[model samples]
Target: MKFLRTALGSAAVSHPAIDLQTSFTAAAQAAGLIKAGQQFDPFANENNFLLGAFIFEDVGVTAYKGAAPLITNKTYLEAAAGILAVEAYHAGTIRSALFTKGLATPANAISKARDSLDGPTDLDQSISRDGSMVNVTPTDANGIAFSRSPGQVLNVVYLTPKKATKGGFFPAGVNGDVKTSAGR
Candidate 1:
């Protein structure tokens, strides 16, 4: 079979192995950002509601993109592509909350230091579980050209924090910035 997937982060190609996906989801829930049977309704109060969600979702999208090239199965590759879309949609929803007037995003309340991607240890910086880098292809204001590396993509997005400038968008943790159906 001819694999038409030539992109570094495409469904026909890049997709994290199932185990990684499960592990990541568990980590997210452990962070208490996700609740069982609860919708993604970010807090509109001057708290870091959307901010927390943004960090989770944005990191997730990039994580998949960073891990995509490492997968060798087409079926899993397609799933990753679908999941990435869902992650993006989640980000958008959180961003929209930022526009709710008087609302404060996590980035707004939490100090940049607390939100930093340095992880739990000051000994080193990490992009993935294995100390690898995160590569991400960031499209511009409009969908167009982009470039990414797994290490650069994920780490860079979370290493720094940013505030949003407009509505219907949440700042990507790294410059930070994903969708789907089936609760994907």
Candidate 2:
């Protein structure tokens, strides 16, 4: 992120210091996805950790794809495309891991939860199987992955279906001009 910021001629100092676990837990609790006292421990359990990893990776790919047209610089657009490829690879790896563990149900539940936050449209997807064939890649009917706008991305991270300036993964909110989340 800092690399991209610098490449765009912006200072990387906008990246704020945050307690990820605490913010995640707070947002999850607020959204009623987890118990009040529970922490968002990525390694607390295999399926649980994989679910978290899959969500972020999937979102990263979509976010980059959605933002591509907004970027005017050819060099930066190329860089973002490369990053989107890497994020897609990460998402596929995590999806495969979830499928290998036979966690389709739980993974789908997480996907649904993300969908709820993002918008009324059910663009989010999960690992599934069609008899003998495993669906490792989440895509549309055309086999292309879906995209999410910056505001939609913020809605998920903020853990709210309503427009919000702060909550979820970022307790104090993000820096810069894009800080508001989209309403579901």
Candidate 3:
């Protein structure tokens, strides 16, 4: 929560409809991902934290893509590209870590949970199948990893295919234009 507080600060940001620090904590608690009065433990919170990191990266990628056309400044565009690269790195690192840990069973369970919440979607890749470990990375035709759109990302976070305003990972809803629905 301290990280959230520092990143989002006390002032309300117009983009994320609610205060990110407050909404994120409330949503995580509401979803039982984190217990009230519990100390933050990275190892204990791995699943949730990874899920959050995935969502964060996806949102950033989508946001950057959406804003690209409107950005007339070259410097801003370059900065956005750098930021996106970092987000991609974060996502890839999480995916690799999960795979390396042989977390197939738990990853699949989490995938199923997400699918149920966001509705059935091909976008949700299970880390394992047929009793074997498998890669869960989203890839393009060349087998290269790809970024997800905001909506696709939300579908994973909300754990449902249906367009949701709020639920699952975000109880109150994310701030800005993203909200709980898929991004355009």
Tell me the tens digit of each residue's lDDT in model 3 across 1-184.
3433344455335433334454345444434555796543323477656654543454454456555665576765676666666766775677666667665555455555444443344444555567555554555577744445566666645545678876545656666655666522
Winner by lDDT: 2
Candidate 2 local lDDT, 58-141, one digit each (tens)? 889999989998889897888899889989998888888887888776666677778888988988875774533556787889
- lDDT values for all models: 0.39, 0.78, 0.54
Candidate 1 stretches greater than 4 Å from native? 1-48, 104-138, 141-184
Residue 120 in candidate 3, Cα distance off native in Å = 5.8
TM-score-wise, the better of 1 and 2 is 2
Report the lDDT tens digits of candidate 1 across residue range 36-145. 54333334434345544544555566567656787688776787677777776775565455434333322332222323432332212112222222212234446522
Candidate 3 has an lDDT of: 0.54
TM-scores of the candidates are 0.39, 0.86, 0.54
After superposition, which runs of candidate 2 have C-alpha atoms over 4 Å from their true positions? Answer: 11-13, 26-36, 129-133
Q: What is the lDDT for 12 in model 2?
A: 37
Error of 1 at 159 (Å): 8.0
Ordered by TM-score, highest first, the candidates read: 2, 3, 1
Which candidate comes out best when scored by TM-score?
2
